[model samples]
Target: MPGFRLISFKRCPYVQRCVMILREKNVEYDIEYIDLSDRPDWFNELSPLGKVPVLEVTRDDGTKVVLFESAVINEYLDEVTPGSLLPDDPLERAHSRAWCVFGTALLSDAGDITMARDEETLAGDLERLGKKLDRLEREIDTGPFFLGAEVSLVDAAFVPALQRLAWANEFHPAMAIFEGHPKVARWWAALADRESVVNSAVPDLRQRYEAYVGRDRGGYRSLVGARIAA
Candidate 1:
């Protein structure tokens, strides 16, 4: 197999998704970490939106193609790899895709909660996220993974968001984001031991994530908590 290069940022959940998939598939790939605030000129040529997780595939014949966006990258990878994370039926695949989009929305709204400027806004974001989580809870199958026996694209897609919530709780137990979502919580607990998920980010991911959220424009300084950094 021709090894690929992953242009990545250390902390972006979007990038984590792709990295996890590569890890899960046991693909031959190398990651080159880049600071989002100080990207090189060629990065603009490769990534239209200047995002992390731009995969550069060098074919056996020396041809190269750069792909961007986490979703597109995941889908393309699934297609090329032997085992499929998506469903075989067209309708089921479409449904899975829709859920992946929903997962993205959840991640976005959670970011809003982290950056909520006031207690009122924070409470509102929490309520909205709570309602959406209830929907997700209802949607969850009896699973160690998203679809029961197998882990799907949905699992890889949403695990990063779930991970962020878990780390945030370590600093500020206020959110209780998973309170009413037992199935989602279970799914997260299951992924906790997954090697692919574990290797996606740095070993000190909790601290890094906290540092970023601690600087949120909102009153999220609490994300760092009182504990001293190790």
Candidate 2:
């Protein structure tokens, strides 16, 4: 509507990434919330996919840049802003960016696990998710953060995922996703404590997310003997 307007959904992790980037950059932007199940027509004009975290940049000259996809938007913001969300070395930057893709893939895998109807399907999806987590565990070194001290785009990319998996572990205590991932556990705990990550989503989110996951006609609620179902 003004300088910068971020179209968002109250609980989307992708939108949260953009929020974290905005907080990191200290950029003041307006936000308009929407329900994904019932999107407004104008939203289609803003995003081809009709998704949230769409940034509408209205420059002083009156031209506008409406951008979709959280990764692309955050990357553009880093270039325009003073500080870097990625590494200085080009190779390191590329590697970090690839992890960002992996982060999204992790989300997909988790969703597949969560929405899996059968024990067999859940087992397969869990293995896939576990393999991804193993890869993430292998990359760990010194970290109060994922890539090191200062929070990078990789950290931004993963804030949503880490929290969800943490909740998943909570919902079913026997299903500890972070088990044997000490470095990742440390990284997750630190990131969870950060002001940027804390304020990224709305309050009472844990309750809301838990309710959503356990809703009627669901797989998550079927936390039977199977660990993944749990």
Candidate 3:
């Protein structure tokens, strides 16, 4: 395995997923946090998609390769490291992968919730988010994680959205994101204190997330978040 460098923005959930995978794998890597609003020249050249969580891998011969997309980067990291975070059974592995994609959709809904500009929009976003959570509640049969005891890449992918949603619920109790979703709620609690999940983001993530979603952006959540902060 070569030296790893992760290009990230502090508030990016995708980058946080990569960070969690890196930590879970115990891979020694350097992280460079950049301002997404003002991306550097090198970054623009390095990342074709112009997104955060671009991973720079330094090969044995000092050659560099850049990998994009959280799912691809995470799988590569898992493959190069010792054990696998994916299930061994082919069907199970594919199932996990499918759920990981589902997690991405959940993240998109989360983004929508945060950026909702009005009550009607927020209500609609919450309804969409709730439907997804309902699906997760049905899908998750295990106690602590998506696949029972051990935390996997699926957990890594989902935790960022869960954490943010937890915060949103806290900032505005009316959201009640976990209501009627006992299993998902339990899953969140289970991963809440896990080392990788806890340390995946910046120490001030809660404050940063609040500011970014609430006061910093012009959204209804911002109004609610700002009021909570005040």
Best by TM-score: 3
Q: Please report, in order, the local distance difference test score of every candidate based on alpha carbons.
A: 0.81, 0.81, 0.89
* C-alpha RMSD in Å of predicted model 1 compared with the true structure: 2.4
Cα lDDT of model 2 by residue, 1-230, tens digit: 23889999887889999898888888888889888889888987778777888999998889998989999999988888888989999999999999999889988876666656666877787788888898899997798877888899999998888887787677565556899788888899999978888888887776566556666553335442233333
Model 2 gets an lDDT of 0.81
* Residue range 39-90, candidate 1, lDDT tens digits: 8888887887788889998989999988999999999988899999999999
C-alpha positional error of residue 217 in candidate 1 after TM-score superposition, expressed in Å: 4.8
Rank the candidate models, highest TM-score first: 3, 1, 2
Q: List the candidate 3 regions with Cα displacement exceeding 4 Å.
A: 216-223
What TM-score fits each model?
A: 0.92, 0.91, 0.95
Better of 1 and 3 by TM-score: 3
Please give the range of 10 consecutive residues that has the lowest summed lDDT in model 2: 220-229
TM-score of 3: 0.95
